[model samples]
Target: MPDAIWQKSSYSAANNECVEVRADAEAVELRESDAPGLVLKADPSVFADLLRTIKAGELDHHA
Candidate 1:
């Protein structure tokens, strides 16, 4: 992921703490602003499914 251009989520405020993402022809990468050295990579379809699941709130645990 060298020289990868990361984009921060719009939901984040004007702060350094945020979730960043980068996508290339091979896969999509995700990382936290606070921890740039750590990254998570996933296939395009898998990442899309993850986004869809999140939007659907399938991972929500609030009572």
Candidate 2:
């Protein structure tokens, strides 16, 4: 995804240390703003499920 047009969230940090996302015909991709070399790619539906889970706080750390 070297040539991918990554989009940063409008709610992200002003300093630019946040997640970026992009999508194409084959997959949706994610990468950290400060670590663009690494990316995570997933099927669009899977990404949607991930977003839902996140919004539901299923992945939140508990202490």
Candidate 3:
């Protein structure tokens, strides 16, 4: 994902320490702004499920 176009959440803090995401035909990439070298890749559908889980507060108990 070295050439991927990364984007951050618009609601991210002004300090710019936030998560960034990039997507390609095969997978979606995620990385931290403060640690770009560390990347996580996942299937698009899996990423969508993660997003839904987060929005639905399914992981709230863990927090």
Error of 3 at 6 (Å): 0.4
lDDT of each: 0.90, 0.89, 0.92
Residue-wise lDDT of candidate 1 within 1-63, one digit each (tens)?
Answer: 577789999988787899999998789999999998899999999999999988899889753
**Best-to-worst ranking by lDDT:** 3, 1, 2
lDDT of candidate 1 at residue 29, scale 0 to 100: 95
lDDT of 2 at 53: 89
Score candidate 2 by TM-score against the native.
0.80
User: Which of the predicted structures, 1 or 3, would earn the higher TM-score when compared with the native?
Assistant: 3
Best by TM-score: 3
Better of 2 and 3 by lDDT: 3
Candidate 1's C-alpha runs over 4 A off are none
User: What TM-score against the true fold does each predicted structure earn?
Assistant: 0.84, 0.80, 0.88
lDDT of candidate 3 over 20-57, digit per residue (tens):
99998789999899998999999999999999999999
Overall local distance difference test of candidate 1 = 0.90
lDDT, residue 50, candidate 3: 99
Count of clashing residue pairs in every prediction: 0, 0, 0
